[model samples]
Target chain A: MSENQSILVIGADPAGLQASKDIAEFGFRVVLVEKRDELGGAPIRWKYHTLAPDFVPTEKVLGPLIDFVKNNKLVIIYSSSIVDSYEQKDDYFKVRILNLKNKSVSYEKVSAIIIATGFEHFNASLDPRYGYGINPNVIGINELEIMLSNGKIVRHDGKIPKRIGFILCVGSRDKATNQWCCTVCCGISIKQAIEIKKILPDAQIYVIYMDIRTIGLWEKLYWKSMEEYHINYIRGRVGENTGQEKNYWLKEKIRLLEDLLKLCLI
Target chain B: MSENQSILVIGADPAGLQASKDIAEFGFRVVLVEKRDELGGAPIRWKYHTLAPDFVPTEKVLGPLIDFVKNNKLVIIYSSSIVDSYEQKDDYFKVRILNLKNKSVSYEKVSAIIIATGFEHFNASLDPRYGYGINPNVIGINELEIMLSNGKIVRHDGKIPKRIGFILCVGSRDKATNQWCCTVCCGISIKQAIEIKKILPDAQIYVIYMDIRTIGLWEKLYWKSMEEYHINYIRGRVGENTGQEKNYWLKEKIRLLEDLLKLCLI
Candidate 1:
């Protein structure tokens, strides 16, 4: 745990920043590298919906990530795409780091390496039926993240749509694409639903999904979104949205009530 | 919207708080009532994990809620429950209030009612095979919440059990029971799996779910939990939790993964 002992961390995201903080805290010299232009790679954030008065602001959940990097005395390289340049000495190896912005490269000898590169988002356009790239309404989770952060709600046509239909499992949990479930979707959807409902109280939200994968206490948030926000979740796959007529959108709007409340289905 | 008018809120949860704040801000007196002694009817916090380094501290999330109450002049009635509450009058409603601690009942007149009464937790003990009540290791979602917050990392026993299993659709999505997805179970389970993996690093966590219902960007959190947490999942139901193994207590513990990480059939 000496300053001379170097730690090279690839990828300057949450994992990389966290590693940098831990290493520096333990008296280790850490140098972080990112292929992206800036930090907070992939523009991904995980959240669950919460109800607030007057849609007032709550906590910035990622404050810790920012504080970690800011407090940690670690070298950070941005807009640099370090590539396969390594020098083999008698006992260890030296790595070559490249700076894409300046078109300059540098070599650094490190004792240890940490590869915290995160995963890529599953393309919703693969299904084609989901219409992620084709339809103005359909957007991936990352794009949705950006929109939610803007603090202003807008629809595909510039005017806010009265009804927004969110379809889950676009490219996830499909046997053809990937059998594994993307675990955070349930929370994210619930969080987004809460936000949408808060911003537009009267707007109708239809969530068509194969399943609602909310487990643990977080299950409470799912029901919170529905019971509080009045969101309607119907179990079904996305069957090619034809862009319905204005009158039909109002007429077809369904009231989802659990007969359990009445002890009978109407 | 006058100070003379008293608004009767059905429950003192998040939604009730918002309603009371809005109405009271408009120059109306608000009465917040809850059947429970404490606030936060359902404890589904966002962006929280026990062992996860990225978990945000409580000061950040709850700070706003605290600030709002201080700024707004409001009345909160604790240890009080509402009974026979409805719009009994044209301008004002006759509401019955009960003090559970003292077994005293009284009546109050109010202008409006907001039903923020959250849903009751699922009674998983009804099913004996699940060992909800019979087994020490087995517990419902609410109990798990307490254990998690109080640090039940390893399991019931001091030694970290090699395997951990989460059975989804416990009180929800069960046809014979509520017949509806409590809706948050799936994502909560995934987040729990990630959390469990974080605490036990090598502990085998399996989420046995019929389906994963993550809507939109919420699917992003689901994916993060699955891909990053290294938590394994099984697409099967636990008919029962009966077996005699290393210990009599651990025997009741559900066996989810044989070799967790590698995913061995045997």
Candidate 2:
């Protein structure tokens, strides 16, 4: 096919990859560009263990799509590349694609351009109250995903957490940080909770949240975590993760209650 | 345009309407079919007051789309109609359209067919434990949406309820009812909670759920309901809503606690 018949698809994410493939299948060349060195988007880059709602392995969902886009003869993938500039002509678009790796520039004309740049995960360290950067224990959900994928749920000290606590809406739904809610975090957190439960059955898990927003079919994750896994859901926002040795009294009271219950059972 | 060049779009909902409009814009005649008499789908049929997450008015979203599809000259609408039969030819499909209202039949041939038939709301009455059909006070989220749109949050006796309890996952995420989670309910319930709070400031709202799966940007609704409206979220499942007077002891205890708190404050 001629250059004018090519479709420029930015961001080699799942959407972009699928778009490129579909357009290519329709007897059109696709110029697929990605800022990252990789082809698959977040699921590949972040190494997502399992997707929420169904908890299907990330590889299982995105593997074939990525492979298809990568191997498609019609799809010209430009990894570590970005669209430097584009000029809309009468019929086609005059585009300048830049390679970030070796500082190379390629100019091409395409009939249409599809922008599929997926979202960037919110920086958890932005909110100091969560003690994300300060406290070693307070890692973001992204890091947790990696851990789950690695088959290890451990604290900064490399110790298995006995009582794990998930603080939801860390940077989301906060006027101070981001006014908008990071919708998937709730589901992701629940998914992680269930995973953690599966790994460490005896480990007590508590999800402190304003609301557990596992919307739609992802509601299964929330339900499963609650009913099957017995993960505790607390309705409240975290004021701050001081990481201080405070609330000893509450711990002591719980211990006493546990002791009393154990004696009664005996 | 010839009949073979036209495209058939099933269900004149938002998706179908949009699809029809787009196909028509591409210089192709679109035959839009709807089971209902109306052009707009669920939002119009259910008289939905406001959509969740953003809480945008239903009309504000679907009204224009419906009007556009209704006015589009290239689009032919068959309301109260069903595709009786369709035979796939070499390059086109011979379709028999039946209109329920007039018992009329129309024959058409289209090159492409777009099936955009949306989902049906789960029947809450199927689960007898919720007392949906038996109890007038126990209504589903659909009924709640209508009530919210009508600007009246009341029981059967037309009295404002002092204590409103929203039981989430009534027919959803239940092994006995539906094993699959009805994802939108969590967000919808939270939206309703906020709406009810706006109408009844003094009413104590409790959302009983296994998990409040208000996933994604809709997390804002959950946050808003909890932070602004102070809606109580109880983490548990309801076995049965017998509508019996067996909870008098708990009510008495709450009353006594309130009295004690009042005395302490005084």
Model 2 chain B: lowest-lDDT 10 consecutive positions: B257-266
User: Where is the poorest 10-residue window by lDDT in model 1 chain B?
Assistant: B257-266
Give all TM-scores, in the order shown.
0.47, 0.72
What tens-digit string does per-residue lDDT give for candidate 2 at B1-266?
A: 34338999999887898898888877789999898988878768888888877889989988888888888888899999999999999888999999998999999989889999966677776776656677777776767787888888877877777777776776665577777765677777787788877888998877766766555577667777888999986666556555665221121132111100000000
**lDDT digits (tens) for residues A121-141 of candidate 2:** 777777666566666766666
lDDT of 1 at B192: 56
The C-alpha stretches of model 2 lying farther than 4 A from their native spots are A1-6, A53-60, A88-93, A110-112, A128-163, A194-204, A226-235, A238-266, B1-7, B48-63, B71-73, B84-96, B101-113, B119-266
TM-score of chain A of 1: 0.73
lDDT of 1 by residue, A1-266 (tens): 23567788888766776787788776767777788765655433322122122222222433566566656666555445764577777655598888887878877777788998855677666666544566565565555555666755676667766766666666666767765566656566666767867777987777766666666555667777887889887655545544433211222354332100100000
Local distance difference test values of all predictions, in order: 0.59, 0.73
Using TM-score, give the best candidate's number: 2
True contacts kept of each: 0.45, 0.45
Clashing pairs in 2: A183-B216, A213-B214, A213-B215, A214-B213, A214-B215, A215-B215, A216-B183
* Model 2 TM-score (2 dp): 0.72
Poorest lDDT segment (10 consecutive residues) of candidate 1 chain A: A257-266
DockQ of 1: 0.18
